[model samples]
Target: MAADPAIRAIAALDDELRRGMYEFIRDARRPVTRDEAAAAVGISRKLAAFHLDKLVAAGVLHATFQRATGLRRVGRAPKVYEPTGGDIRVSLPPRQYDLLAGILLDAVLAAGADEGARDAAVRTARERGHEIGADHRRRTRPGRLGAERALTIATGLLESHGFAPARDSPRCVRLRNCPFHPLAERAPDTVCAINHAFLDGLLDGLDARSVTARLAPQAGECCVRLTATT
Candidate 1:
């Protein structure tokens, strides 16, 4: 039941943004200018800049620069902004693993490997890993090397493949990306299989037996540790 630190951080950030956005638009009488928004939210202009930037990035606010009142200046008026058109809409909630977990569960049930899904998932993952390795072999040009020298190459390969692999510790590398955790909610087996496939492919030739994973339910911190085999 412990919260995943990563998930907690993201959730906190999302909440802060949501709160600031709400206050920024509360006046409802006029367009909420970014500076006005900052004052309303009780945050500094610079801090406001970052949050507003996120809002813009999330499509929650649209920006248009126009002239504002300038003090003791004979040049063009300072630029100002306000919420434009209509109230901005949030495209989607923060990315969570709920949906991904469900997908995995469904995949397993559909595959009819409920009881033995874990093993089946591992095999599926292994195959997928092999395919990825083969693809790497095809796409990579020259400078061929053995597995020992290929660690860096493999790491890069996994990154490009969307694994977001990071070295969490000396001997353990953790995976930070997974688009399937939401599916685990509905199809845990499927998610497990998909995760297995991902890690298998990612750590291919790095000693398969050395890998182990821990998936937090609804925490969105699914991690895989690449440990050395005894």
Candidate 2:
């Protein structure tokens, strides 16, 4: 059987030396070379290189070749290690605490000046959805979008974002699942408001004059529904 990618990635850091090296590289403002990693972990350069390569293979770190100094040198540029943007977590039945933490952090930051966190989240979510819609328009070049075409584009966007949209009728699309899920259950008002605003902004950005986003929350379904206007 194939090893789970997340498990393999996490197992790479099981070793004390590799874990220490990973922490050092992650905490550093800049990438670290094999030599620096070796010095930090009190290991030989060859051993450090082996462990670092393993980390790279497991997707725990990213490797880039760059000259240490600004000036180009005769020898090959040193290999540097940095933490990968991706994260690895192993959980049975899948819980996403990180996602919750991120949302909470955003809300806290937005509340710094006594502003409403839900309002801030809704604004941010809408802006992001608008950006996605604008990008989709630019890529597909769907000129002078009509109601049908706009619904098609919106459905495609929703599917890409894991919304599982189903066309209930010519005038309505029902989402089969809530991408935000349990978190939405935990904070219905905040999550649903943000979700509604996001879809609203998306339709606006797509210039879908004939369709509107409405909050029609139902059990086991998404909080927002896309409805075609007359």
Candidate 3:
């Protein structure tokens, strides 16, 4: 199997010269040319170009050819490099702490009260889950979802969120992975509550009337489980 693209991209920065050049281009107010990057890292222009191209291939930098002042020049314009606009992350088993932190911070800012932050976070999580459920329902057009249909939709949605849901029975699904992970371990009550409410909202929005979100905490499993009501 091939190496993960993200891991390869991150590993490319391990070289001393390449790391220096990357930082120079990233902090530059404008895109940098091969000459400027070479001087910044004390390397030859040819060597700088070689490393820069490697970075580009790794998706760490973007390359473009343009005149220094964005005007037409008599000679061929210099190739400029800049940091890629998006972030690159690599994690085995895939924990998304950045996403969780953003949600919490957004809730805190929106609520503007310390006491209400948790409540806000729960509401935000539920609303997001509801929107996802509603969107999935619209796209799939599975009208009046029965227990099996609801399980299928639920499993897909959970899997997309990194829950690793598996069907335990026709009426119950077991989630093997927790996207929140250690945070859930550190703050079980709050995190578990938010997860429950989120799943509840998802079921509601999905119109999976035969299913209900229930807290059935088990070792090495998600805090909430979806079960058939009848």
Instruction: Report the number of the highest-lDDT candidate.
Output: 3
Count clashes in each candidate, considering only residues at least 3 apart in sequence or on different chains.
29, 0, 0
Model 3: how far residue 155 lies from native, Å:
3.4
| lDDT: worst 10-residue window of model 3 | 106-115
The sequence of per-residue lDDT tens digits that candidate 1 reaches over residues 1-230 is 76443344345347665455545564454545566777876777777777766655444455555554454656654333444334322212223343334434554655553556566555555655666666666676424454334545555765654456667654555556654444556776566556665566645533333444444332544444344333
Scored against the true structure, residue 35 in model 1 reaches a CA lDDT of 68
Estimate the TM-score of every prediction. Answer: 0.38, 0.59, 0.78
**Cα error, candidate 3, residue 68 (Å):** 0.4
| Cα-based lDDT for every prediction | 0.52, 0.83, 0.86
Q: Pick the candidate with the highest TM-score.
A: 3
Q: Root-mean-square deviation of each candidate, in angstroms?
A: 10.1, 5.9, 3.4
The lDDT, on a scale of 0 to 1, for candidate 2 is: 0.83
**What order do you get sorting by lDDT, best first?**
3, 2, 1
Winner by TM-score between candidate 2 and candidate 1: 2
After the best TM-score superposition of candidate 2, give how far the Cα of residue 104 lies from its true spot, in angstroms. 10
